[model samples]
Target: MSTDTSARWRLRAHAALGALVAALPAWASAAPRFADYPVPAIYQGRAAQPLLADAHSRNYATRLRDAATEKPDFAGRYVLATWGCGASCTMSAAIDAKTGTVTWLPFTVCCWDADVEDHLEYKLNSRLLIVHGARNEQGGGTHYYQFNGKRFAEIRTPPRHAPHPPGDHQ
Candidate 1:
């Protein structure tokens, strides 16, 4: 294709994608708020040692173990352990404070849009996980996820119902 023809085609594709995103359901396109997915209650028991036998966990055993020492930083009873993979790239695993299970994030977050302040945005008492970057360096966009006890699932839509924080209005 001619340079001009290719440029026009790319522009049209971008526009089409934007229009589709705009037409999506609010929950699908909108970022989930931290207050919308609060845990019923925070875990109060002692943090357990990370189970290093988990798939891919042994490679980062030391890091995960060190992170296990800290209180839960994600969901209700999980500590988010993160490490830099390269420039503007990071890998993370969620260490269960109650069961010591390790669940890695679905992909390496990298090459975020310039507007994103944090690559990973999460709340200590909520299951919503916001990724403000490309997943595995495929594309640049904001992705919403929910911790499903085993792994983080990309959210195409928010839960039909979820508990709010203790004092927040319904």
Candidate 2:
């Protein structure tokens, strides 16, 4: 090919490569991969037995490995795992530090906040776990839960106000 023709071809190739590289991050982020973050050994070691005993737990265990977002050392002795089952549906499980016991919390509906992109929050140095969920058409609210030696149980009254718009309130 002539010099001008070859130069044009090279420019087009460079542009195509640049476009592909630029699109990679968006493509990768479109689906969150749980495998990217493996469950910690503390939880993984004890999860096999209980997970194998029941089919549902086994499925959840797989999903946990595939999609769950883990917070290690949560509450000083527990590793908290959260994953989305579907739109607005979420599930959580906790691994006890002392016993390695995995406790699966009830499946919660409308637990996702599209605005903030998170469903769970924990207070520093406090045992309170605030779970956000939709209450009605107006908005969503938070339910406070406390780990009561056995499981996380809802304590104290939930927030009464509607969920403020993102950036309006935190």
| Predictions: Cα RMSD each | 13.1, 15.6
Cα lDDT of candidate 1 equals: 0.81
Q: Please report, as a residue range, the 10-residue window in candidate 1 with the lowest summed lDDT.
A: 161-170
Best-fitting candidate, scored by lDDT: 1
Residue-level lDDT tens digits of model 2 in 111-169: 44556555676532345566667532234565556665367776543344534334212
Model 2 spans > 4 angstroms off: 1-55, 64-71, 109-117, 135-140, 162-170
lDDT of 1 by residue, 21-105 (tens): 8787653435557778888878989999999885589888899999999999888999999999999899999999999999999
Q: Residue 133's C-alpha lDDT in candidate 1?
A: 69
